[model samples]
Target: MENKLMMRLVIATEAILFISLMITYVYFDLSVGFTKQSINYLDIKSTGIFSVLLFSSSFTLVQAEKNYSEGKIKKLKIWLFATIVLGSVFLFGQAKEYFKLLNNHFNISLDVFSTNFFTLTGFHAFHVIIGLILLIIVFILTLAGDFDRPNSTALSSIGMYWHFVDIVWILVFTLVYVLPYLLK
Candidate 1:
């Protein structure tokens, strides 16, 4: 019960922060307008691919939970490993995009678009890294027979967090990549 309550509070607080950043992003977009350079520089296709991978982690996590509930520790570990791999790939994609932007001189300080864009996406990426770390820890613990029991609160808590991170990515991906591309 305490674990769940703590996870709920963390999720609520994080939701507020992400919401504020998203609103800030929209405020900048409406106030300053997205410059042609910014619009043209946005890579919808590549990021969409990564976004799919990130979203898939949520499903893999569910599989892990199912395996845990059925007393299949090895299967649970495999699913968790799959979740970690998918999330890592997504992060790699995000980093690749960041490097490409920096190489093209489209950095955080470039303009309002760049500033808010990086801020919003950077926060999301940070959350992903944290999620990855948590998942890795859980995986290690499971390997050591720490979570052999069915009532694993740690796994449940991590599931909530991982799902939250994935949902946030969906919103960010739509706002940063999809909406801009469609409107342009």
Candidate 2:
């Protein structure tokens, strides 16, 4: 109960952090001159693809939890592993995009747009990394038979967090990707 409460608190704080960053991005985006064309610089289609991959992990995670509940340990491992792969693919897509942006000279110090873009998305990427680490640990534990009904709290806790991260990315993808194009 205590751990779950703490997790909820942590998630609330994380949501606030991301929301603030998003608001800051909107403020700067509206106020500043966009010297670079976002359409040309950002591959929205590829981003959408990666977003789908990340969101799909949520389903896989639910399967993992369900399998665990049903005592299907091997299936739980497979689902957890799928979640990890999807997450890693999402991270890889982000890294590729970051490198492309960097090569285009869109560094953190470039301008307000660049600054807000990097800060918001960078923090998101950091969260994704943390989620990946947590999931990896859970996956290893599952493989080692360290997870069972009595010991499933950690997995459930992390699953909540993983789902939260996926939810945040959905918002981020909408705000940072879709709306801008529509607004343009």
Q: Which residue pairs overlap in candidate 1's backbone?
A: none
Reference-based lDDT, each prediction: 0.93, 0.85
Tens-digit lDDT track for model 1 on 1-184?
A: 6888899999999999999999999998998898977878878889989899999999999999999989999999999999999999999999999999999999999999999899999999999999999999989999998879987688888899999999999899889888888888
80: Cα error in model 2, Å: 0.1
* lDDT (Cα, tens digit) per residue for candidate 2, span 1-184: 6667788998999999998998888777778755547445778899899999999999999999888888888999999999999999999999999999989887888777777778888898899899889989878887787776645477778888889999888888887788777767
Per-candidate clashes come to: 0, 0
Sum up the clashes in candidate 1: 0
The root-mean-square deviation over C-alpha atoms between each candidate and the true structure, in angstroms, is: 0.7, 1.5
**Top candidate (lDDT):** 1
